[model samples]
Each structure stands twice: as C-alpha cells, then as structure tokens.
Target: MSWMPPDLPSAARARLEAARVLVVGLGGLGAHVALLLARSGVGHLVLADADRVEAANLSRQPYFPEHVGRLKAVALGELLQRIRPQMGVTLVPQFVAPDALPRLAAGCTAVVEAVDDAATKAALVEAAVAAGFRVVSASGIGGVGAGLAVRRLGRLVVVGDECTPCAGATPPLAPRVTAAAALQADVVVGWIVGNDSGTED
Candidate 1:
C-alpha cells in the first residue's frame, strides 16, 4: 500500500494527479517549495525565476556547489526531474509580469508566491487574486532575528517576511531563507491535504 491516506477520496487523489501549480522565485523559499511539491506528487509545476545560482548560494539554497553559474530554474528543474521522473516540470528563466499572469495562472489550481521583493510579491498576489488563483506568499523570512510563519490570506497563505537587504540591497543569510521555504511548502501541502493551519491573518 502507498503511504498516502487511505481515506482520501478519489477526487482528492485526482486533484493531486491533475494539479497544476506555479512557484515563482528560485532562491531560498522557491527551491524548497518546488522540491517538496515534486516529492508530494504535484503533477505539473511551472517554475519562474530569472536569477542564477551564485557560489554564495550553496549554504541554504538547494543547488549543489557545482551548479553555481547556472540559472536557478534550470538547475532546479534538473533536480526536480531526478526527484520525480514522471512529473511535468517547466522552468521559465524570465521574470514573470502582470500581463503574463492570466496565461500563467490559467489552468493552475494554485500559485505559491516565493519571490523576495516586496513590490514583486505584492504584484503577484494582486494579479493571482484577480486571476482567480489561490495563492500562498512569503512575508518575513530573512534576518538573524527571523523565523517562519504560516498566515492565511483568504484562500492564500503568506509564508514569512522579506529578505534582509544590505545598504547596497543584497541578501545576507541562508538559515531564515531555508526556514521560510519549508514553511511555504508546509502551507502548500496543508492545502493539498485540505487543511489550512494558517495563523489567520
């Protein structure tokens, strides 16, 4: 017998089989969410990220040290394929736009907002909501003082918080990034299992 719940309905099982999810950003949160979703049997994943992995990303990000000069989406795509050879994973190495939201959100059952920029996350949330897609986003997931949170925003849940920016607007640590990513995946899986343990924001 499979490890999945025996009591789950065929429809719920089918939901997993036919599920279409979009995960934006491939840094910390996005990487973790994509890995978990692939492992959880999500059928189709649309990954969007314009950034490439850096030598500094090896500590908390999912990619190996050798993957440092590669586009994040491509590197993660390879990893996802290795995780689930049968799953459909598409990597778009371009920044998603509000105009593209309709097409991207089309046929998608849910969208996970793992982007780091405040303006970008807000834009994605607005567009996804307008496109009628359920969304989960990250809030406060950076800083030496940071931690994870699961907050519900209607049918959506925002993970933690924004990444800490340097005076030159650069990211600092990896621990909080990984924590936030795990929380984002937790919310997504909770939704898959028909539970929303969001902190009720």
Candidate 2:
C-alpha cells in the first residue's frame, strides 16, 4: 500500500471507487492505462482483450516473460486485482464486438480506447459517445519524440501526435506509449474527480 499514491480523501475517493470503466484492447496502450486507473482508485474495471500475449509484447507491455501465451485480458485482470484487493474487475477474453459495446459500456464512467487499429479506435469512440459516456483515445502513438497532445472532440479526448501512424516506419516504443497512457489515465481520473480540463495539453 505504501507504493500506492496518497489517497484522494474519503469523499472524492468514494466517488472514484464507485466508478466503473471499460478499457478496450490490452496492448501497449490498454494494459498500462488499466493499471493506472486501478492505481488511481477507480473501483470496477471491465477489461476486454481477446489476444494472447506473445514474446514480442513484453517489450512495451506490462506482461512478464511467463505471461507469454496467456490470454491478455485474463493475465491483466488477475494482476490488477493483486494491485487493488477490493476492486471489482471483469475480464472479457474475447474481442469487443459491435453488438457487445452497449452492454460493456452501459454503466461505465468512461471508456478508454487503447487499441492499435484505426477503425477499431473510431468505432469505440463512436459507441462511447452514442452511449453518452466520455472517451479517452489515442492516435499516431507508434514513434517517440513526435510529441503528445490532447484534442477534444465533443465527448471524446484524444491523446498523441494525431498523425503518427502505428503502421508507419517507427514501431511502438515504451516511453511514448506509457507517456500517452499516463495522459489518458489522467483524463479519466480528472473526469471522475470533477475537475476535467477542457483545454489542450
């Protein structure tokens, strides 16, 4: 518990602990974002990711060497619980299909979109907006030093360069990925704490 940050005081902590958040995609972005929200005291987390961990994923992801070949959602759900014993975590070992979006997002305080695919990111933002929940998403997050920025579009907050394609020459590195994830997590926490900044980063 000493490793955890100072508490948010009883009142604000209660508000945060009562919130439920759905984090899509357990890759470089989602994995770190989920952990951050948990550490920030978000009570219930719905983690969705169908992919299994591969050796290559360990480079930037939060997985251990032994975690390779394990289902990402399952592995992370277990770890997040160890970080916050009283937290409620639901693991969806399957991909977040369009039909399942509403059910998964219904009561969530916010949806954090951390998927690599551009189309999937767009779909998540759309669904979260339609369901009347704010979304924190990313774009052009592959390279380092492109610089990170926050852009608001209605109920959506996007972080990243806004132009560096993940499929571009530069592959995803940890510094930028975790930095962006931190920014995303901060936005989610800000919304829950009722001090969300609407300005650019």
Candidate 3:
C-alpha cells in the first residue's frame, strides 16, 4: 500500500500524496504532466480541456489511437485511473474560463498550464498566483532538438524555451514536447517537496 519509492523520503511522499493539482490542458504538455503526477503519488488531479483527441495528437500527445475522437479530459482521466486506480481525478470536459480559474484553483496546491494560447496562459497564471497557488506554465515545445529549461518568476514557474512557438512550420514531435512536460512535472514535485528555491535555471 506504500506508494513512495525507496529513495523518496517519507515526508516528501506524504506531501505529494496530500497535494491536489489542477491541469488546465490535455495536450502534449498537460498529458505528460498529469501522467507523471499520478505516477508520482499526487492524491488528486482536476483535468480541464475542451478538445477531443485528434489523429494529429497521437504523434506528440499521450493519447492512444483508440482515444482519437474522445474528449481529451475523459481520455486522460481514464488513463490516469488505469495507472493509479485509487487516485482522485475530476474531469472537466469544457475549456476552463479565466474567471473560473480562482475557484477551480482554490484548493489545489498547484496549477499546471499546458494550453497553447499565450493569452490564456497569461490569464491562468495570473489567476492561480492571485489565488495563492503555485503555477507552472509551459511554452515553446513545438520544435525539435531544443533543450529544456525551468525558470521561476515570483510564484510562477515557466518551463521550456521561450523562443519556440507551435506554429504550423515546426511540428511538435514527441521527444521535445514530453521533455518540456517532464520539466514541468519535476518543478511541481520540487515545490511539493519544499526543495524548490524558486530560481531554478
């Protein structure tokens, strides 16, 4: 019944188990973040996304072929439940409105922003921070061969390069996108374990 890895301190594992996270997208980055958090023993996750799985998402996101045409939130929720059947997962099948973010984030220890739109990301970050929840926002994982980086500004932690945009020009291959998502997940874990100095390079 113990979920902690042997190397993980009991205190850290307890912290992770008590944490609730809200993931505000189910794309490549959000999918990875949610999956990692579940595997890492986060007790609860609220997944919000309006889009359905598409064939194109299979290349970079975590959806299986069978998930295509299903709601991303529902698909990811099912996958997370399969991974950790005891974990609490709430699926919101519609896009989260910016004004509702504070209410959604009220009890969450952190908010992970994996939406593609810059404006939406900004609004989410602002709302999460204002609500006193740690926020991790992703950007620039659309291209190939770019390394990952984590930077913190105030209560907001930004993961991935600031230069890469997911325009039609460069496809978001799985490697780079997953790498960014891993970084986002790691940052959240760090915060949960009280090891984040808020200035990771």
lDDT leader: 3
Per residue, candidate 3 scores C-alpha lDDT tens digits across 54-154 of 99889899889999999999999999989999999999989898889988777888899999988988888888888788899987766777676788888
Candidate 1 stretches with Cα past 4 Å from truth are 1-11, 145-147, 161-172
With a 3 Å backbone cut-off (N, CA, C), the pairs that clash in candidate 2 are 140-164
Which of candidates 1 and 2 reaches a greater TM-score? 2
Model 3: CA > 4 A from native: 165-169, 197-201
lDDT of each: 0.79, 0.86, 0.88
| Winner by TM-score between candidate 3 and candidate 2 | 3
Estimate, for each residue in 106-149, the C-alpha lDDT of model 1 and write its tens digit.
88878888787789888988998888888888775545664456
Give the candidates in order of lDDT, highest first.
3, 2, 1
Candidate 3 displacement at residue 126 in angstroms: 1.5
Candidate 2 C-alpha lDDT tens digits along 1-201 = 533347546677777878999999999899999999998888899999999999999889999998999999999998998998888999899989756788998899999998887787788778778878899998888766777888888789998888855454668788889999999999998899887844654
